[model samples]
Target: MSILNHRTVVLDPQFKDLEEFMLSIPALFTENKGVVIHKGRNELRRIEYKGVEYVVKAFHRPNIINRFVYGVFRPSKAKRSYHYANIYREIGVGTPTPVGYMNIRKGLLFDRSYYVTLTSTCPYRYEDLFTHDFPYAEEVLRAIGRTTAVLHEHGYAHKDYGRANILFQQLEDGSIKLEIVDLNRMAVGPIDMKAGCKNFERLPATPEMHRLMAEEYAKARGFDAQKCFELMQAYRSVQPGKIDGLY
Candidate 1:
């Protein structure tokens, strides 16, 4: 951990060698030196340092109340994201390798923050399955379902489970490797059938796709396939308008 001028930074031990580059993120971000990947409530950029590719997420500055909350009582989103990424790795879940996180403070309150991770090599996101005629769509969806089941079984529920957050690639052995990103809002605890089914609400999938994934998820969790499908459909039905790439 490094602290200077009301800014605190914590790096994963494995990435200690990149401390200098990590420390320079605030300046680099302010300079707008990286290629922008997404721009919205928050911003993500792909940057290179010493020929190494990294994705840096600059979180929006919190509101006054939230600044105090995040500064004193709660972890900033960047910190949570870094923490959860390590937890995912520990539990054998796929996520981009966390490099570090930095939190800037304004007086007694939190200001902006950034989270850094190595760029993921996966070429396909879950949205591709819907937009394009992705090869082996059924098999990939099944793998996604199984991976989600594993995630839930390990007591983690992605609060923002959406198509864009899921990245997948096919391996040589015909298995799909799925990696999840944007990890700040995750619920960690025993997940019941209802919560598990509701987790699918944000994924934009056709009814048939939902059924396929539901059945596969049910098989992995040993739940009744029909019940799982129905519950997932019910939850998906009431989901609010698309929010931040979710649908």
Candidate 2:
């Protein structure tokens, strides 16, 4: 039930004159020794070049339909991830700052996926900081709750709202900065309290942890606990059977 209050428009392929972007690579990865920061089955890679970080998201799809869908309907979650993060940042929240990124390409030959601006400092995921104490944990959660409220208030819905989509950043003072990632399936529509509530409901719902998260979120966002309770209960009534291959 994600709403798309804002339509994240991606750069059209027609506007991509590859020759112009490729020219900048010579001073980065080519002459410098960049190390891998992160890697995934998504074929997305983050590399450090010339003391700066860059994310390169690659896709291996020869299917024309895949290309068409990627180009139009479902834009790169990579870029959307940044856009949402920036939205959070502008509102006194902590999100990874995006510099700018090149559209994923293999030199001047073919285009693959979109590369997002990389963060040299943020944690890969919230789980990445399980061992360490994130000082701004409460602030981070409030920030998250506020972000969720903001999205709903703005008429946006996210395709994935699980734990993985929520990432943590360890600032210089050891404070945790929360950020959302993996955008691409956001939608635009009038707010349906049900859909937004279902997103929070479909979360892990740990016996203790989720209860605490809900309480914290309620307190942080100044949302009524009873409202969230009704929403969760209503959403649970129409639960689906099973969804496999959801990684």
Candidate 3:
């Protein structure tokens, strides 16, 4: 951990050598030195340092009220992302390795912040399972279901558990390894069956897909499969908006 000037930087001990590089991201971001992977509410860039590839997420500067809140009371989103990544790692959940996070403060208010993680090697995301006929689709979905149960059992709920945020890789032994991203909004605490089932509401998939996943999740959690499926369907039906004809 290092605090210099108006910037506060915290990095994983393993990445201590990258402190200087991490601190330079805010400046390099302005110069557009990396490949932009996402550009919307937040900007994500794929950048390289030496031979290592990393994804740096530049969080949008908070609004007036939030600036003070994040600066004084709350942890910045980037800091939360970095903190959650380490938790996921300690619990054996799959997520890109977090390198660090940096927050630039102006006076008493928070300015821009960035979260950095090692680039994920997974070639497919959860959306691909439903969009195309990927190999081992059923097995992969079941794996995701079991993984979700594990997350809930561990008291971690991803608020933005959308398709794009879930990633997976096919291993040599034909087993699926699931990974989740977009960590800042994750809620950590005791989770009930209803909340666990409702967590699937953000997934973009068909009813059949949801049922299958719910069943697998129920099996893992020792809950009634039918009830789990029903609860999941109920929550999904009432979601504010639809995605890909389903919610």
RMSD of each predicted structure? 3.5, 8.7, 4.0
Candidate 3 Cα lDDT to native:
0.86
lDDT (Cα) of model 1:
0.87
Per-residue CA lDDT of candidate 2, range 1-247, in tens?
A: 1222112224334424433443344344434434444445555456554555655444354366555565555545456555665665565544455543333433222234444455635555545435557566555654555567666666665556766667766567865566665654565565454555666654544333334444554565466756765655555456532222121
- Cα lDDT, all candidates: 0.87, 0.51, 0.86
- Each prediction's TM-score against the native? 0.92, 0.62, 0.93
Q: What tens-digit string does per-residue lDDT give for candidate 1 at 138-165?
A: 8888887898898889988888888899
lDDT of 1 at 15: 84
**For residues 1-247, what per-residue lDDT tens digits would candidate 3 score against the true structure?**
3233388889899999998898889888889998999999999999999999999999998899998898889999999999989888888889999999998988778888999999998889988876677868888788888989988899888888998999988899998888889999876677778878888898866777878898899998999989988888888888533222121
Q: Which stretches of candidate 3 lie over 4 Å from their true place?
A: 1-5, 240-247
Tell me which of candidates 2 and 3 scores higher on TM-score: 3
- Residue runs of model 1 more than 4 Å from their true location after superposition: 1-4, 240-247
